[model samples]
Target: MRTLRMILLAGMAASALTAPSAGAAEVTALDLGAATAARLAMGHVRFANGHDYNATVGFGSGAFHRPGDPPGTLYAVTDRGPNIDCAEIGAVVGMSAEALCAGDTAAKVFPFPAFTPTIYTLSIGDAGVEIVDALPIKTRSGRPITGLPNPLTLTDTEGAFDADGRPLTPDASGLDVEAVARAADGSFWVAEEYGPSIVHIADDGRVLVRYVPQGLEKDLAAADYTVKGTLPAILAKRKLNRGIESLGLSADGRTLYAALQSPLVNPDTAAYKTSRAVRLLKIDAATGEALNEYVYPEDEAASFTADAKAGKVKQSDVKISELVVVGQDKLVVLERISKTTKFHLVELGAGASDLLGSPWDDPKTSPSLEATPDLAAKGVIPLSKTLMLTAEGGPFPEKIESIALLDESTLVVISDNDFAITGDQTKVVRIALDKPWN
Candidate 1:
């Protein structure tokens, strides 16, 4: 089978998350669909010119590296486009999105309702990786922008198709963008698991405003560009496609940090399976309001279980993909669970605990900021974390969902190869920051 999957990706590219005890951390990776090729897409089922959209260019879902780049250049992003595996057309086990392909309604919720949503740019260093540019995401008179969804009961009212199964028309400027943050005048602000919105593009990729969350603002006002509901309202209780992955900005960009990739079906879903409180935002990036809020606990999907009694962990697995800002109010978060991935270091100081309009965003508080029990004995408190890096080896790659810190001793890391059709491989890895750069 392709030489046992290239010997299990060369033993997970020698992982153990690249030991760093004093070994001065170092890890490399590279592999990004051999740096693109053409024959893009059209009606692919698996291949034919309609496939190889270069493994759908999953673009690490969100990354950045500017500030006098040219070093190892970085800038990835891509999500909500080119989806697959609604059980490959049968879609039954634990339905999601278009209710897992709703009886194959021609694979709704996008098989590629015209993909678009891109941003690549890579380049990396130490002699490998390439791609140098890709851009797509538009609409400021430019158009494009797909990744279909939004335009119904508000958010993931999912539904779109057309590979002959017909019915295709979602995309109220669809955006499931997931984490990205860049703005020292270059603009860019991503963060959108559909309607968890937070957009703000400009600097060339168009889109100028989208905020979403308070009552879905007339379901994104007939969007095609520019929408703004302005968040909070208990984040409208998220959890459709798990809202707002992770987006950050402060360091004078005037605050803005999101992060809530799970644990909200709020008052139910059995309090979202024993809630590990998740809801972190500190906005005001020029008025989306919500100035502070905390409580961001997760990881305890039996604490990152890669495998337990062969039952392969569950509890909705866990997420909260990436958050960067590194210190001025701090944050470095990451945290994943499909096998393993970690990185902590939070610190929102001023003694944490804001939880916004508190009472733990009621859904009948009781024990529900994800089962509170004693958040510093109810004075709340949560924003404290430390760990930093934890993917301890064994051929990992189901999704490391992009992260970048590129200098101050490099850290890059990327993944979300669902485009690799689950052979899941979009390696970028780079690790090497043990210390002395903080």
Candidate 2:
């Protein structure tokens, strides 16, 4: 198979590779070329762990398309800023790990605490990818919002600190956005992991309405935008940092579907670590009301062919990163571990059990929905899933959090690169599938 590669070199020219046979698949990395508008200048930071932080704009957090946009145009959003755990900072700051973070192990230090989440318009072609425009997400007052963690009142929260080991106040408007979907009316819906919430933004990037789980409204009361407690309350059980990561919008933009990144802690953390039961929500786009919910059984680590080959044997490592709607009640879900990614076509219309108001939604249930191993034996039917593609090794990189259909037979994927904190460059890859998804 012919594989194309591109490295970001100043004034480097891009070349196309020969296409594979009709029945064979191909993967090619788009040459981002030189660092221009897409690159963020956060200066340099010497971490206590002997690692220097290199600033780069995280363009892969989420991606979407405007219905009437150019064929190769896509809009992408960035996540929060560069952050490291206190344990990582304690080592370099000459302080004990426990003492430096005020005994909160979940505490993190943001080197660039003011980095704002922004969206970019990209154009893809044979020459590579080009950044056409950018829009920084803003509040009602027109001020950009940071990516800092929110101080949740009803749900779990983490502490935020600065480079000097000083505590940083949490921002109610802070959002760790993971996915984006555009509506027919020009507004955008973004999935956030911090509130595990969904935010609606006007065409100009101004926050319109923010939706969160029940009882979590008070926490974001200080936010500049309107807040609604419209999601299921069980979502508060989402594992810290692993909330709603994937989102999909129906063709007509009347419905929205959100997928949890992992199983909920339901009863406790032990259940979350070993459970394969992830939740998917179908919401009313116009009202933010959760219409129904479905179980999305994430595969075990051993099932991911690439991870097995690499000997990474933890089922908890699997996560749903992105979703693409193909047809009515039909969508493609992106699941991945660090080194491997898989796409599965999921059907939610027939034969799937809706657990909306069932015992599974109740936190008091004895065997939390997540703790149940044999969901089928329990008469609980999950959404039907068929593996569409397995992307392993080469061309593909770690933390590929965004994907879009470039055409009926091809897909474009982007890696998060964690803002290049570890010296990894963000890569955009195009994959030609063996068969057309249409």
Candidate 3:
């Protein structure tokens, strides 16, 4: 029996490696233990031509030079299929290739057709996670939309609509949208790097409200209020501080955790060094007001940066990507660099509280933070069970972009394919979270 099982397992891995391109990969029979969820719900931004680009690049292929010699393609595994319908949105018309390619010619000549947003539902079956349906989402104005690399398109245009077919404007300037999170109520919040930093959108893609970090009203007030001139100009003047990139709400749906995508630069410094501190700000879910800011310890920041600079490690940036609430006051953060993805369990200390004054807010009462030096001192506690998913299956290259928990014990991971048309592959994979991280 052991011999037979070994053969079957070897064959499965082999088949997976050489599987012909067809529809998306599917799983029909998964033997997950009781600790894991039976049905995993997953969401991602997939391209029609089976290519995915980094949210940063917007439209073009992500190609760069390694430290040594020739430049190579930055292979992303997150772009999978169920192509976008660009015509549904205005993306197909009057669309400039500026966002798609790094070079002018590359942007003008990229071959993929324009597309609009379509939700593809995947079911875990005997085969694996497979696409069950592709449903088109309509805006309040009755037009279809797709995601683009530009923040204005991703946040301001893709998911929004006015009553009379005009775009619902955001309140603050330079609100370049980077990522999005859906709420339990079906409403969505977009994380923008530029200010009017965050925008709240209704299900029909209407801009219901906007959230700006405190202390920026004067700068915004000085600008003419037109999204084009005001938002980007202010963002540029402020040295392009891309505020928030990742966002997650509390399990109870009252508190929000927003992660800054990059370090803030000190204008006084001659050369840009990684900010000594990276912050995870807590906010009131109801009002989108700032509750508290948690800064990473200096030692931890130094260690992360050293690893990246040494070339011994790849993901040196240590940007926080996504946050998940695990227990009452405990949260899990997905921190990624160019080459590493780490899952951290953070306990915001007691006295660290939320807007509603829930017990979970009092860091003094919570063990994760109260016993520690300060709420910010606890730094990110490394969970023993870590999964080192590679860019490729083993030696192959893949770039993981986004992750979502289908339940407590199952994780859905998506890779970005960097929109390469040849010599690249996109993947969406699932793994058990119950496995030992240590």
Best by TM-score: 2
Query: For candidate 1, what is the TM-score?
Result: 0.32
lDDT of each: 0.68, 0.81, 0.38
The TM-score values for the models, in the order shown, are 0.32, 0.91, 0.52
Q: What lDDT tens digits, residue by residue, belong to model 3 across residues 262-330? A: 444323222113343444566776777666655432223324432455565422245655555555546
Give every collision pair in model 2.
48-92
1-438 in candidate 2: lDDT tens per residue? 454443323333454333233222656678887754335556776645445656878789888765566778887888887877776655444455555477676788787888888888889776778988888889999999998989787888889876655788989999898988878787889999987899999989999999999889888999988989999999988998899989888888999989999999889999999999899999999999899899998988787766778775788899999998877878889999877787888888588999998999999988888988899988899988877766665666778899887666767899997777666777887776667764
Error of 2 at 49 (Å): 9.3
On residues 393-417, what C-alpha lDDT tens digit does candidate 1 reach at each position?
4444556877877676677777777
lDDT at residue 425 of model 2 (Cα atoms): 75
Better of 2 and 3 by lDDT: 2
Worst 10 residues of 1 by lDDT: 1-10
